[model samples]
Target: MSSHYGQFCPVAKAMELLDERWTLLVVRELMMGSRHFNALRRGVPRMSPALLSKRLQTLVRAGVVERWDDGNRVTYQLTEAGKELEPIVEALGRWGTRWIPELGDEDLDPHLLLWGMHRNVDLEAVPDGRTVIRFLFPDVPAPSRRWWLVISADGVDICDEDPGFPERVGVEGSLRTLIRIWRGDLDWAAALRSGTLTLDGTAQAQRALPRWLKLSPLAGTPRPYAAAG
Candidate 1:
């Protein structure tokens, strides 16, 4: 733990623990139901594994997180105190989506985006069958350009490896456009009409995509303040 504020107050006390770099984001991931260490890293990919381990240990000591060992893998979960931070995390995301300045190239990451979409996609909206959709981001690194979403009644699997299965839909677009679409900054119809996003493969897959993709939960939050400079 870092040095104390040398004073006693609720806000200051909380900040002493949660305000550290990556601390709140770790909490945010835990609140978002990330149970595995690798899963948490997806939400904050730039954070080093060593630093993340340290943060997890710090949070554990702070009684904000709990670890469970099942003989196979050790999973982490937020404790009661950690669960209390859901509103805080939600508020932060809502605020960022509303007031944060316009999107930039640096803000788009295909790996993280695919990881988030894997969890946020509306599985029920997809037709009842094995659906494979390949997303191609032309501007990203070649290795990271292609992402495959294999969705079935069981669950969704995101991978860079080709599953060899016939793709039901192929989406070719830049990462920025996809991010904008996901953030609700750009509408699906507009992207399609503008040709920034291309839809191919089966007709059903293209039709189901709009309904299957449910944007960030905070996407609907309204911005009451002016955009940041």
Candidate 2:
């Protein structure tokens, strides 16, 4: 109400609630199947805990989110009204992919990239037993440069520190290059051929790695440049 534009337009009324910073991002996380509070934080890592809590409370008040407290753990889920925004969020992703093809240096986040990749692990495509893949971003600073993805029948887990498991594969590349590959802005084979990306592991692991970790949801969005070509 306080952020309202005082207009009777439906769009204006919707913007009154949805235009707040981090509001739709919270919804986006929910749409992506992040149910717990900490899991939501991982989706928007840069947002402060206090701000996230506030936003969650606001969403609860708006009836867009339902908070369940079973006394043991509290989980957040989108109400029917909130679930309706999925198409909007997806459309925004596709629009950005096609129009905003270039990324600024500040937009490249290794943490977020790794988190997304972890979520996109194709369980059926990966090996039957536990498989560990280490990703090295040499361009990043220490403590943040190395990451590991441990995948199994249970699920996928990402670790910044060494998980102490024997790594099945190692991928070394610049952060930008890897992000570009994940976003479909660049090709995996092209990056490898240009030496921008390298895989050091068993022949089979290297061959199946790309299939094992499916790229971003919007990666397949056709770009304008490519369409013109």
Candidate 3:
């Protein structure tokens, strides 16, 4: 894990521990309070299980993570040293949100998108009664292509399996389109006009979508973007 920078600086020393692939992301998940192994994997889905395990062990060795047992299952938690990294992780996310130029096809992941949505939905806009919104993403794999977001005054439930509730509205589109929509890179009206995004359901539900759907936290933040040629 040590990549020598050939410098005697503290920054270089820090980089050696933090620069490993998936290391910071694992930290991000931990900082976000994902304690179990499965939750961490969901947060960083593309990382191999073997590698995630290795990364966690490395962090523990570096005094950033601690492994413990609750007498039922093993758990991992961040040490004070790792907790100290919260601001750095957040700054990196904000910086990337503001400066990352473009997104590639490989970057579109339904699991991650839904996970983010589950964590960020604006409950205040939820319908007074039980409301179901389904999404169809043709570009995602069959198992994850369809998603149901069931929300009520009580709470929001995001499900990969069919919740079987009568949906009030449905959104059908490519996975990338949905990702861009959430990221605020595409205008909802323009998307509908272009037929890239389609809405189905009661006129009332259709009309309420734009206002009811709360997007990414960084969606409104102005960023320097680079267009693809």
Candidate 4:
């Protein structure tokens, strides 16, 4: 059966392509500068690699993505048509933030949270030289419970296993609390005051944590209920 709407309406035609599961998300990852397949995988951690590859091929066929082969490494990038979807994607995000703020337990993923946080790190605000930040989500099980972000002049690298760095800052909190903070459902000061989150390490490290780690851009979108307050 064909997925086409068999109509001339532009919206229907677009939905025939974009409405496929994980399709726009692939586009979202591309828009966020994930050029490599592995990087895109991080953005959609729950997606199977085979499914991801299938979506990429679909987008490439639609002329929204371009796959580049430099012999040694292959990378996927958004074509000009894909780039045009940036504002549309961002608008959908903002609308979702404003109107649909509820997140189910299944919606929370520690790996994804770290991926977004690591990507948006404010390198300028973080201290120079090697800075390792450890994240502990005790509520999560096993290997996924612990994580580290090693930042340096070289950039940020996330590790599920200990990087064995001697000096490190610590962030410990329930997964939900941290996700809330990241999504702007809860603020840092409020979480700290309520004892939902904690930061450890040098006083400087504690002070710099919020400054250097940027939250989701949609995190600040004004909600209707918030505006009334």
> Clash totals for all models, in order?
0, 0, 0, 0
TM-score, predicted candidate 1 vs. hidden true structure: 0.93
Model 4: weakest 10-residue lDDT segment is 220-229
Q: After superposition, how far is residue 158 of candidate 1 from its true place, in Å?
A: 0.8
Our tally of clashes for model 4 stands at 0
Query: What TM-score, over all chains together, does every model reach?
Result: 0.93, 0.96, 0.85, 0.96
Candidate 1 residue lDDT tens string, 1-229: 7679988899889889988899998998887778998889988998999999999999999999998896798899988998888888888888888878377777788988887788887887887788888999999998898999999988989989899988888999989888877877777888998899999977877877988878877767776654221
Note the Cα lDDT for every prediction shown. 0.85, 0.91, 0.85, 0.88
Cα RMSDs of all predictions?
2.4, 1.7, 2.8, 1.9
Ranking by TM-score: 2, 4, 1, 3
**Positional deviation of 118 in candidate 4, in angstroms?**
0.6
Q: Which regions of candidate 1 fall more than 4 Å away from where they truly are?
A: 224-229
The candidate with the higher TM-score, 2 or 3, is 2
* Candidate 2 residue lDDT tens string, 107-198: 88888999899999999988899999999999998979999999988899999999999999999999999999899888788888989899
In candidate 4, list every pair of residues with a backbone clash.
none
How far is 37's C-alpha from truth in model 3 (Å)? 1.3
Q: Pull out the clashing pairs in model 1.
A: none
